[model samples]
Target: MKSVHMDVHALLDAGVIERRAAGFILPYDAVHVDFFLKAG
Candidate 1:
């Protein structure tokens, strides 16, 4: 099995996410996403 710690550490260093007492978070209060779907 592959260990994800290395990758997780990279993300942590990049400020893309933050760590909490319980776990990691995306560091944003809220996220807004837009989806475009092409209906056939």
Candidate 2:
């Protein structure tokens, strides 16, 4: 879970996905969040 969060954070910082208040929400055409989870 921590790794997923870290990956999501990195993605957001890299402009891969848009940041959100509740959680790491992906952009309209961005890849699925599952990618991040599995990446972790």
Candidate whose TM-score is highest: 1
lDDT of 2: 0.73
The most accurate candidate by lDDT is 1
Candidate 2 at 4: error in angstroms?
A: 0.3
- Mind giving the per-residue lDDT tens digits that candidate 2 earns over 1-40? 9998898788788888776788666667646555334553
Q: List the residue pairs that clash in candidate 2.
A: none
Model 1 vs. true fold: TM: 0.57
Work out the TM-score per prediction.
0.57, 0.48
RMSD values for the candidates in order, in angstroms, are 6.0, 5.8
